[model samples]
Target: MAQLIDLKTFTDKRGNLTVIEKVVPFDIKRIFYIYGVDESKRGGHRHKQTIQAAICIQGSCRIYNNNGSSEAYFELNRPDKCLLIQPEDWHTMDQFTPDAILMVLASEYFDANDYIFEPYSAV
Candidate 1:
């Protein structure tokens, strides 16, 4: 089972910033963003070894994730809250606002062969 990481969100008169430096509980190796998708569009894929933590920095979106036998839905609307994604879990991102900015912190660097683009028929 994958764990959910709750990051600290600091606010001030100026603004706010949430930092997740190295040596934190979860090991982060890569950072990426998904943006500019059309309405109702979705990203369907899963990683073999990459664990991800995603945040909605600009707008709102929903994530549907399933771990073979169990499933979960996460509503990402705040920049401070992040959803931790486990390896080998099927995931789809949808219901995104027009200006949605989904930022992800990955546990491993990019490897094209590590991804499973097809859904598991047995699940």
Candidate 2:
């Protein structure tokens, strides 16, 4: 199962900056976003050894995660809150606000074979 990681965001007169350089548990190698989807649309099929941390930078989103035995729903709306997804966990992200921007931090570089696109199976 994945864990919720609450990040520290420092605000100042200039602006607000959230420093996540080497402070996060996983090694961030890639960054991506899921956006422009209509209602009832889902993303993320499966991952092998990749770990990801996702945050709703703008607007709100719901992430459905299943790790064979347990299922959990994470509602992300705050920029400081991020959900760290473990390997082999099947995640389906949906219920996004129209202007929602889902930012993801990946532990590994892009690898095509690391993703499983079929129906999720217990690993």
Evaluated with lDDT, which candidate comes out highest?
2
lDDT of 2 by residue, 42-96 (tens): 7566788899999888899999888877888999998888899987678888899
Q: What lDDT is reached at residue 38 by model 2?
A: 87
Poorest stretch of ten by lDDT in candidate 2: 18-27
List TM-scores for all candidates, in order: 0.85, 0.86
Candidate No. with top TM-score: 2
What CA root-mean-square deviation does each model show from the true structure? Answer: 2.2, 2.3
**Model 2: CA > 4 A from native:** 12-15, 118-123
lDDT of 2 at 99: 92
1-123: candidate 1 lDDT, tens digit per residue: 344556786889989988765424467788999887677657588888888888888898999887777777888888877888888778889989889999988989999988888876654
